[model samples]
Target: MGFSDGVIIVLGLALFEIISSIDNAVVNADVLLTMSERARKWFLFYGIIIAVFVVRGLLPLLIVWASSPGVGFMGALTATFSNDASVRDIIERQKPILLAGGGLYLVYLFFYWLFVEPKEYAFFFESHIHRKLSFWFYAVASALLLAVVWITIRINPFIAFGAVVGSTAFFITNGFKHNAEQAEKEIAHSKMTDISKILYLELLDTTFSIDGVLGAFAFTISVPLILLGNGLGAFVVRYVTIHGAKTVRKYRFLKNGAMYSIGSLGAIMLAEAMAVHIPVWTPTFITFIVVGLFFWLSARELKAEKIIA
Candidate 1:
């Protein structure tokens, strides 16, 4: 890829990561309010290293390496940048499985938010779906999984398995997230030590970071680029957690924007995995447009609310 293209992709990945994790940042900010200054400082200082290098960096590398074990860990790391056709071919062969798994996970995430999670409605259909179909989230998820697997299995059984893995991942992480929400509430209200809260926050951060890391694939398959983009995003989230979480919370429709961008990315990934062609820059541009539109709506809503109050 050219330097300009790489720059755009990285910027897209970073923006997507930042917006997607706004909820996590808000939660982190809430818990930090209960901690000592020293504790907050330690978490912010050391936590960034873990969040950036360890979680954001290592997770994608691990995903690539695990998917393409033939490409040694180092090989997988450099494969995207490598000019060697053989190396590129190996990565190409494995890309669909990786994309399939990650795509299903992402699509499921979007649907869960639309059907089950409570939110300030961004569109009329969102509220209608939640009110009437919330209980059918599981049924919808199951049917979606079945359909994806049945379609992919005829073409490639492994791709089908990858979709199953993705669904499994969604359930496992969703359970953890539900539990973490309860934990965060209890920790916030209790006499938990600063050290304990910090550890809990770190764990929570890791869980949340998974969404961004997986979504990063929709932008590019390059591991180094993923690291750079996601690393920058993690820093932004930390900064917002410290300085701008309240300001961010006021723009409520931003979450709607993030979820919709996620669904778009998921569709892009799934289509690519099915041998359809998409421009390398498609994910990046689509994300920018979707997020930008929702941000405008949010700003308008905030302005109207202030005038009323």
Candidate 2:
């Protein structure tokens, strides 16, 4: 990539990272508010780092490595008889698939953030709001994921693109409004327990970091660059979470705005996965619109609160 292309990619990745992480900030604030200040700081720092590096970066690399022969310790054994083609060809062909998967993940993440209302963890059926899948269900899901990755690796690009698009459609149908409202209500509830809230926040952060890690791959394979992007993005998001949490108590509209921004990102990611071409300016435009609207709404709410006071 040229300097200009590099700049565009970096900025695009940063914008996606920021947008996707907005919901994470809101979720973190809900939990961190209950922790001691020192604990909160520790959680913010370590949590983001782990989410970015371990969960997002290393995990995906492991997935790719496992699915590809000769990328790991089994290399020598496979190398003797494997005619599985060149590493460069594998990387080049897989690039689109990786991008597509990243896009689909973005969409699923959007629905998860927007539509899947955070519920209390329950060991029994009575306490469950969303139906819990059994261990077998999860095992099956994991198998399916592996299969998809394998197929993507071996199949024609058009077929892979179609499958990605189809998945995106299924995810987008889940929508965000219902879950967004539920999260807002939960945040407002006096009975909201801290531990559960913290867990939810951690999960959200991990989800948000997925795109950042994947997008970093588009830049370079250097683990350090990936770490740098993840670290910087996580730091900025933590700051946003802390400040937003402090202010959101007084300006509830900000939380709503942030969630909306996150939802939009999810949408964009899904679109990108489907190979839909969004212009470079689309994210910035969406950010400005959401932020401006939230600011106006927050001002109104603040004024009303002041009047009542």
Candidate 3:
């Protein structure tokens, strides 16, 4: 895309991101109210920027890099076998940059998931897998699994098995210490102060941003465009949270519908990450339909509640 074309695409993406993120904002508002004003502001500023950076700027770079040569011959081999011209082109043109990008994302996901969802430590009387394993064991397991798949692509079964075992061991051995520290924090903050709650909500918003940003890249690569779309979407979500919270107090069904939308989006994102290509319109249509259905249902429920009173 040319400069002008890129500009237009970016603008459109911004608008799209804004619209998509409205539900996020609504969900955020529900949780944000539990946070202190400072925490809320921190989320509004720092959290949003981090989401845009990781999702829009960082992820594509990683994807492109992973498909490139030298960094990982396995990834290159896969791209070549897949017969995807776009992946091939990215490898040839942007391999080094992409490799660095991908490395960053891997690191980011490791820390993010670790801190976000720490696994509980168990002692004896555990399952076979748990009894002998440390946290790194699971990471090694995942690495081994990937290595097996990578090896299968090259008809090298032994190497694949070795790769999986090696990678799994490396990650598991190194992982979990951070998670252990985070677990302590969670325990100490069990009371869930307003600030803590707001921070939690902000992290939730960041999680929601991952898919939206990734999907936005399927349309355009310009960082500006992705940011624009995400920013607009987040704005709409914030608006909904403010207004919906007020109006939906009497209509529990509306809140339920909103929650359903959030849940569905989360599922859709997971599917997308796994290479499932549900059209963007699917979520867009569901958003409107659910909103309308909730409105109707909420009205009836509220009316019934009044009658009983």
Top lDDT model: 1
lDDT of 1: 0.89
What lDDT does each candidate get?
0.89, 0.52, 0.48
Task: Determine which window of 10 residues in candidate 2 has minimal summed lDDT.
Answer: 120-129
Clashes per prediction? 0, 0, 19
TM-score of each: 0.95, 0.52, 0.41
Worst 10 residues of 3 by lDDT: 95-104
Pairwise TM-score winner, candidates 1 and 2: 1
lDDT of 1 by residue, 1-309 (tens): 899999999999999999999877887898899999999999889999998989987898899887788889878767755676787789879888989999999999999999998898978989899999899889988998899888889888988888899999999999889898778767877898999999988888888878888899998888889989988988899999999999999998999999999989998888877878988889999999999999999999999999999
Per residue, candidate 2 scores C-alpha lDDT tens digits across 1-309 of 366544454454454455446555666676567666776776777766776667755654553453343456344223323544565355444445455555444444434433344432222441242354332333443454455545654655543653455356435533443454356446534455655555555654554454455445434433443454555666677787888656645655554454455556545544543446767546546755875687687788789879999
The parts of candidate 3 lying over 4 Å away from their true place are 69-190, 235-309
All predictions: root-mean-square deviation over Cα?
Answer: 1.6, 10.4, 11.3
- For model 1, name the residue pairs that clash: none
Which TM-score value belongs to model 3? 0.41
Candidate of highest TM-score:
1
